[model samples]
Target: MNRTQFLRLCALGAALAVGGPAALAQTYPSKPIRLVVPWPAGGGADAVGRAVAEALRVQLGQSVVVDNIAGAGGNIGTQQFIRQPADGYTLLLATSSTNSANPYLYKRTGFDPVKDFTPVASLAVIPSVMIVAAGAPYKSPADIVQAAKATPGKLSYGSGGVGNSAHLAGELFKSIAGIDVIHVPYKGSSPALTDVMGGQLDYMLDTGAYGQLKGGKVRAVAVASATRHPLLPGVPTFEELGIKGMQMNAWYGLAAPAGTPAAIVERLNGAVQAAFQAGDLGKRLTDVGAELRPGTAASFAAFWNAELQRYAGLVKLTGATLD
Candidate 1:
C-alpha cells in the first residue's frame, strides 16, 4: 500500500529470482532422487543402475532410488525419462541399447538420444561372450561356425531380443563367418541364456553369461573384445580365434534430461569419479565382466556421439530393424 513497502517487496523478489539456481545448486539433492533404468529389473542394466545409485547415495547424501520401466527396446522408458523435470533429480541409466542402437533400429523412438539428454558419466563396457551348454559338442568358435556352415539353418542362436547388442553380434558373426544360423529372440537375456543352458538353444552371445560360465552351467567359446577378459582369461577373443569384423561391446552411462543445470551435471560427474575411485564399484563391475570406464560429462557426450554414428553403420550393415 505504501511506496517503501512496495520497494522492499520488489527488492526481495529480485534477490530470489537472481539467486534461485545458485541457491538450489548449493542445496541440490535436498530430497530423494530417482534413477530410471529403461530395462526390466534383475537384468544387467538394473544391476548397474543399483550399483551406481548406491554409490551416489553415499556421495550426495541423498537417497537414489532405481525405477525400472521396460518396454519397446528401452524406448518407452527413455521417452518417459526425457519428459521429467530437468532439475537433475531424475536421471536415466542409459545403455547402448537405448542410446546408440535403438535410435537406428526403431522406426520412431520418440526422443533423440543426443538432443534429449545431458551426459553425466560413462560407467562401463560389457563384453559379450559366445556361450553354449556345458555338454554341447561345440568346444570353440570354429566348431560352432563349421557346424552352422555344414547344417545351414539347423543350428540356432538365441539373443536377448531383436536389435539388441547380442542379436547384432550374432548377425555380425554370421556375416563374417559366412554361416547360416537361425536366430531366436527372447524377451530378455535371462530367458535366452536359460535356453542356451537348457540345450533348447544351440548358443548365444551374451554379456551377462559370466555367472553361468563360472558355475559350469555353460561354456564360453569366444569373447567379443579385442583382448581376453581378465575374469574369463581362458577364453579367447574373436580376433585371436581368427574371427574378423565381429568386435562388439555394450556400454552403460548416466544421463539427465536436456537443459539440466551444468553445475548439477558436474556434481554428478564428480560423484561418479569418486565412485570409481572407491575401488569397490570397479571390482564389483569387473566381477560381472564389465570394464570400468569412468569419465567426465564432456567426454561421455563425445563417446555417446561416436557410438551413435558407429551403431548407425552397424544397423545398416546388419539390416536390423524394429518397426
Candidate 2:
C-alpha cells in the first residue's frame, strides 16, 4: 500500500486501541462480580463487604458476591485477590489490617498494599472503643489508666491477635497513657470479648461492642476516636480524657487489582458513592458502628496512602510484629 494508506491504517488501529478499554468499561459487570472479604464470615469486614455487595448488585444491575478468604491476618486473602485479573470483576474489601498494618506487622506479606491494588472507593471508618467487663472496677478511661499506673503490667488488654488493629490501639493507648498493660492475643474478637466479660482480661478494644454494651455484657470506657461515637454517645474519646496520640480508626474500602482500567475504577467508585447517598447502606453500616466515608477513587487512594504511613509509624512505635 502507499504511504497515505499505511498512515490511515495506523490511525485506525490507534482508535480501536483507545476505544477498547472504554468500551469494555461501559459493559462492565456483564458477569457476576466477586467481592472478597479478607476475614471470617461473621466479622466486621465480612458484614461490610456483604452490605456493599448487595447495594452494588442493586445499583449496577449485576450480582455482586462476597467471598470470604480468611487467614494470615488477612494477608492470604489479600494476596489471592491481588493475583486476580485486573478486569474490575474481582474486588477486595480492604481494611486497615490488610492494606495498612499487615505490611509493617509481618516480615513477608507477599503483596505491596500501596502498589498491588487499585482504589475504588472508601466505604466506612470503624472506630474502636476501649471496653471492660460491665462489672469491672474501671468506670472510665481515667480509672483504667490510673489502675494501670498504680499496678504496672497488672492490667491486661485482650485483642484479636498480635499486630491487629485492636492490638495496635491498645499499644498506642498504653504509650500515651504512660502505663504498663500486658497484651493478651486471641484467635478472634469473640473469644477475646468473651474473656473480657469473664474477667479473664481487664479490658479490650473493639469496633463491634455496641451490642455487647447494650446487652450489659461489656462497658465502654472510651472510644479511640477524635469524637464520641454515635452508638456510644456516653463514652468519652481518648483525647477528651487527656490522652493524646491514641486516636485510631479501622477503615474499610473497595479495591481492584493493580492496573485495572481507570474507567472501571471510576464506575465502581460512582456505584459505591451512589449507594451511600441512597441512605440505606449508610444506615445499615452506621447501625453496625461504621462511619460512612464515601468518596472518589483519587480521594480514596490519597486516604489509603496516608493510612499506610500512619499505621507504619504506629507499628514501629508499638514494636508490633507478627513474624
Candidate 3:
C-alpha cells in the first residue's frame, strides 16, 4: 500500500513479465557475479578490480569473480565484454581510458562506450603526478618549464606508450606551457619510470607510479588536480600554480552491459556505495593513491559524458592516434 511497497511490487511484476533469470532484481546475484577487468594481472586495474570484487562480494553476500581480458590497450577485452547478456550478474571494471579515451585514441574500439554500457557507480580517481628523479634539478613545474625552454628539444619525458594517459598529460603540459620536449614511449610504465629514475628521462607523469614515490625515490613536482592530494600535500596542484586545464584523473567505476534492469543497477550501485561506507574498500583504494568517489548511477553517467567530451578535446589537442 505504501510507496515503497508499490514500487517493489511494480519491479516484481516487470521482472515476472520478462520471465527469466533477470526477473528477480530484488534478489539478484543469486550466484557469483563476474567482474571483467580489461587489463593485465598485477597491474593497477587488476588490483582495483580484485579489491572492488571483494568488497562487492561482502556487501552483496555473493562471490564476485575477476576475469582479466587484457590486450590491445584494453580494447580487445572490451570488444568481448559488450557481447555479454544484459544481466546484473556481469559487470565491467571500467576506467577513464576504456570508457573515455580509447574511442578517440583508437581507430576501432569495437564497443560503443556510450551506447553499449550502463553506468553503475564511480569507485575512485587516481590523479596524475609529474615526477622526476629525487635529485633532479627541476624542483617545480616552473623549474621544468624553464629548463625545457632553455634546452628546447633536450628535455624529454617517458610514458607507457603513445596515446597513454601519461603521454596525453605530457602533451597537454607541453601545449599549455609552450615548451619543446620529446616524448619517449616505452612498452610499459615500469621501464619508462626506471628511465626517469636513472636520469635517462627528465620527467614522467603517471597515476600508477605512486607506489614508487616513497623513500625519496622520486620528486613529485605537481599533481594534476584542482587541490593537493593527501598523499602529497606539500606538492602544489597544477591549477593552484596558475596552470589551468590540468586536472587529469583516471577515474574507475563499475558498469554493466546496456539494457540491464534499472532495479538491478540501483541495487548494485547501493552495494558500491555501501562498500565504500564500510571504510575498508575506500582505505584499500586510498592506500594506492586513489581518491574515493561515491556517486549514484545518474551522476556517474553525467560524469562519464563530461569525461568523454574532455577526452575528445584532449585527443585533438595532442594529435594522438592509435591504429
Report the lDDT tens digits of candidate 1 across residue range 1-323: 79998997687567558887665566677789999988777667777888899989988999999998878777888999999999899999989987999888877899987889999999999998999999999999899988887889999998777777888888888888888888987766778888899999999888888877889999999999889899888899999988887798789999999999987998889888998999877877887789999889999999999999999999888776662
Structural similarity to truth (TM-score) of each candidate: 0.92, 0.89, 0.85
What is each predicted model's overall lDDT from 0 to 1?
A: 0.87, 0.85, 0.85
Model 3: clashing residue pairs? none
**lDDT per residue (tens digit) for residues 253-313 in model 2:** 9999999988899889989888988988898898779998988899999999999998888
Error of 2 at 285 (Å): 1.1
Q: Clash pairs of candidate 2?
A: none
**Steric collisions counted per model:** 0, 0, 0
Q: What is the lDDT of residue 70 in candidate 3?
A: 72
- lDDT for 141 in candidate 3 is 91
Global CA lDDT computed for model 1: 0.87
Lowest-lDDT window of 10 residues in candidate 2? 21-30
> Which one wins by TM-score: 2 or 3?
2
Query: What is the lDDT, from 0 to 100, of the residue 169 in candidate 1?
Result: 88
What range of 10 consecutive residues in model 3 has the weakest lDDT sum? 18-27
Residue-wise C-alpha lDDT for candidate 3, range 133-173, written one tens digit per residue:
98899888999999999889999998766666777888889
Candidate 3 accuracy as TM-score = 0.85
